[model samples]
Target: MSANAEDKLVIMNEEELKRKQREKLKKLQATGGNPRPARTLFLFNLKNPFRKACTSIVEWKTFKIIILLTIFANCIALAVFLPMPEEDSNNTNINLESLEYIFLIIFTLECFLKIVAYGLVFHEGAYLRNCWNILDFVIVFMGLFTFALDTINKIAGVPPPAPAVAARVTSQPDPAVRRKRRPIPLIPSVREADSEV
Candidate 1:
């Protein structure tokens, strides 16, 4: 083809590339994602051991399984801790406060592990930016708040100190009667009153 046609062809290719870029930007905006995703380093970096281990196939599988188990455990704990209806009439079998605590610990650890793997910025819809991550964070925060409230309630519910016992009052014998019965001696018996006998 002639040089002019070749130049036209090259311009058309450039236009096509620009069009694709524009579409990409639009798509990113629509999805609430950054068109130009930010890059971060440190623990989340590819070379970091945390990121490496987390992303590894075997490790990821184990991590996922553990997370799933924790969720299941949480369900069981929830069922156990839920108050029974009046109709059920004291049929509750288990007290799951301890289980719930275990679930919270496991859930918290899972979230922390994910954050450690994905980095804290959560830019590009990763880490804290992801919906799942946000939900986990909120849940953990609420759990902490609930724990605080529980502690406060426990402290407040404690019985107040018992009131002091009342002291009994007795009538004293008449001083005149005692003096008459003792009879005053001219010399003080054994005990001297100062120097004057």
Candidate 2:
């Protein structure tokens, strides 16, 4: 063969070899051949039953975490507003109010997004039947109650009462207001009635 033809043939063979190598690498990758050892705990396969159970419990979705965080925020707000001597100060009250307001806004937005993503039927409890759905409804309702209470208190020239305090004060029934029983009147006998007449 001519030197020029030989050089061209060598170049073509080299290109073909490179192409084959690339294809072989791709096939190995596709099959996960020669995988690197798992470096982290997450990559390791679960062998212990307890560890597997724990992993299953902790492997929650992003939406589930958001719901849990929303619930936790509201619970913290509730704890802040509880009728304790430590929380009765004006500064603490204001702080708690602001925290509650922020949590409510976040929860409201979260509910809106859930409704938009899942549609009205799903948001209204068409699918899931669990504690998360119940908590979502409660948080939304509590947010609305807080807004309404704030408006009413603003209009009435009074400070807004915390829900914990309001619930405690209203839930107690007065012990002094028990109804008295009326005495049954005895019927007079006929002879006694005649003598009286």
Candidate 1, 66-143: lDDT as tens digits: 888888877776666545433232334444655567778877777666665555664454567777778889999899
Provide the RMSD of all predictions against the true structure, rounded to 1 decimal.
18.3, 19.4
Off by over 4 Å in 1: 1-59, 80-94, 152-197
Q: In lDDT terms, how accurate is model 2?
A: 0.60
Q: How close is candidate 2 to the true structure, as a TM-score?
A: 0.39
Name the 10 consecutive residues with the lowest summed lDDT in model 1: 161-170
- lDDT value, candidate 1, whole model: 0.64
Candidate 2, 106: how far from true, in Å?
1.0
